[model samples]
Target: MDGLPMGRRAFSSTSPSFRATARVGVAATGVALALLLVVAASGCEPVPDGTPYDLVLAEGQVMDPESGLDAVRWVGIRDGRIATISQIPLAGADTLDAAGLVVGPGYIDLHAHGQDEENHRLFALNGVTTALEMEVGTAEVDEWYREREGQARLNHGVSVGHLGVRIAFYDDPSDFLPSGPGGYAVATDEELDTIRSHVRRGLEEGALGVGMGIQYTPGATRWEVLEVFREAATHQAPVFAHVRGFGVEEPGGSVEAFLEVMGAAALTGAPLHIAHLNSMSLEETPRTLQMFEEALERGLDISAEAYPYSAGLTSIQSALLDRYETAPDTALERLQWAATGEWLDRESFNRYREEGGAVVLHLNTPEMEALAIEHPFTAIASDGRIRDGVGHPRTAGTYARVLGHYVRERGKLSLMDALRKMALIPAERLQEWSPDFRDRGRVREGAWADLAVFDPETVEDRATYAEPALPAVGFHHVLVNGIPVVRDGGVVEGVAPGTGIRAGSWSPGS
Candidate 1:
């Protein structure tokens, strides 16, 4: 490992992580030794008359990021929920041989942008069971939510872009329409009422909340954001923000500046999720972590996401990327399509900047890059945008790289710690918007059979900056709903009888 650092206790030096882990007794598996006791949660048992599950994943190695459990065990699954998890083996008609492999819940992606046919397969390849798109980039938020749910191989979730709601409602990117006591901006207060009605309608239509890209739309007023956040907060949905100045290096342009957006959430008591905080901080990695920590200490419910790749994927067409293009470094040179080996040259870059490629930025600091996984508020996201319709590395490389670099090679964090960020924490965060978020982040019996099996020693991310198309190695089996999607380094086509999941249509309080 070229850039491996110290304090990394989880890497397996002698063999694949799974083999090394297997040789050691339950006592020495690092944090992996602690999560063996996944007792049934209180008050979360089967209903009085509900039918039991269809399958059970018996004893192997169960890793629950929430409780930080990492040990060899057995799990029982019934009717798509976790039944019982213990060293005591229970009877089951079906079982999986997860011996010598890491078995944890499938990942919950907080801010994946693209959802294509191949990318769905690519996400399946990486063991991502649920993904929520924050910004409704190309499709209508209503249709996009229903569309992916209708066809995905993995369970999918969505956030209605405030930008989408704005554009869709206003249907015009014009100057001020009305705002003050007497003046109306979008139109009369009656029309403003109608727009607010539309935004609420999107939330009711199943958008998790709103996605705000403020820098991209400078014309959007703060009241506009507050207007919808109040509504989403009422519905118990958090606002997902791609805060104004992202991936920029200037005054008020860093990741820290985005905390102001987070502050707004805190002010209104709305849950806020910062989009790709890691992508914006290559040089100020320490400061960014501190800022997020301080906000958490302030009692703000804020979380963030990052991709494993130092570089992020987006088109140059983003309005915010254009404002920062005054420098040569910031100028779009060429965006090498990850899906295709072909290159979109500098000329194309400018054209796309105008036409909208929102070119992906490559993050290069080893420390800041490592922070993507090490930071507390941060979770893994691919920022995977749909290109004519193929997948990107983040879809295939994130978890594998989380294993290979942070835990296996670099030793920045423990394996269980990484799983917490990749699985449990994201699941908890999702729970704010979706009930399954709480249920899915662990490996108890009867939970969604979304599981990933891998040999720690050999499990490494193979995708590179140049070879971004290659899928990583080491995952032996991946199951969704008790159906094997990946078995022994091979993917089973058409077995993708996987269904989509919609969350929080029912409010606990309201």
Candidate 2:
């Protein structure tokens, strides 16, 4: 392939010089030397001159929130890593002309639950490069990673879930979102030890961190929670949690839930990540952000994330709806059936609660949702999951919605700021757990080539409550590991370059 171009080589046995060389005793050697010289000269011939890359995105407005770089530039990718970012042209096997588009790191979803192929496709179309199961993570972390190997469309990872381990320890029948003994019964001292052992084993086996859905497992005592935190601290893994409760109402309220996790973080010295703070705090989201800021100020490694939507999704069988039996009106008023898209009244709520299905609660106001999203410290994460094809629009549209509504339409956030929340912040949060994340979430050279290219003026989410599977628009291309998973505004078929992102491969300081 490196030989001189076809029909361009100067070789002719009938020529006078060739004939002269043939007449000599060392004709073969002389001709070979001539050919070598010609080949060397051909190496200097003008071919495609720029540095060769596997892929090149040309003339795009590149943005890197971490470095605060936003400029029109050419980006080159080779061997699944960013090879160059230059003002000059680049040569590649494939080139995507990204004129008038914004090129940035692909969104990383820290609290995502949809790790299956279908949801991954949706996530790719929405410009998410990594989708993790951090809230209700798996019991068998090794099995989960193995099953998705060579099959996923986006980078994926999971936490060693407290709820899943508890269910497994108690032989509970639930597969996800505890409902039976795991949700309602306090564990014995021996049972707690078993659960802790399982969590530690999972972390050792490359689970991203410990996932605790304290709200799902109300029966989990403070001691059990503390034990999980201690295990997390030992492994230097952050704990991703849906706190113990929600709403501003007393007894067991959202404030108390926040305090529980905060105290655990303080006591056990475990990093804490609060999930879906907008939904959890609802009207009190501003206050919650203030608390998170204060926690940061106090030298606590605490962070939080929120989706753009004003609703939250969960299983009806989970303990989150346990209050519905008595105070049905307030709960039912905010609840909507995910499958049928119907606003749940007392009658419908009761039926679904017994039958067991996913429900969306309109627990947050639009103002509060926006406030949480605009919070400087809050990252954007989709608490996204899908069943069959029915689920929250956030499963397909969270990142795009932020770019579209929050940044472009409403001007609530700068484009760079939104990208920061979606990309750099999430990567920063998990880089301590896995060194693989270090090169992610940036557009500079030597970074992993996970990128999203979209029209800044046109990018927006179209998914809605009635039809939640709709993919976002205006994303010209989305690449995972420098492979185009989405091209020309559609998901490419039969390409899966995604790899499992695991922890424990490196220590925090390393």
**Best-fitting candidate, scored by TM-score:** 2
- Tens digits of per-residue lDDT, candidate 1, 1-510, equal 111121132353543454444445444543532432322223334322443234445445677766656766656666556666645433455666666677888877776665666665566666677766764432254566555554566667766665555555555432111112111133445655665676676676666667776655555556666665676677767777776664455654666456667657876777877777776665766777788888888888888877776676654444545544555543444345444444555565555556433344554466678876677558877766444434456766777888787787776677777777877877777676777665676776546777777766677776665555467788777777666677777777776545555457833233
Clashing pairs in 2: none
Clash count for candidate 1 is 36
Residue 268: error of model 1 in Å? Answer: 1.3
RMSD of each: 7.0, 13.0
lDDT of all the models against the reference? 0.62, 0.83
The estimated TM-scores of all candidates read 0.81, 0.89
Quality of model 1 by C-alpha lDDT: 0.62
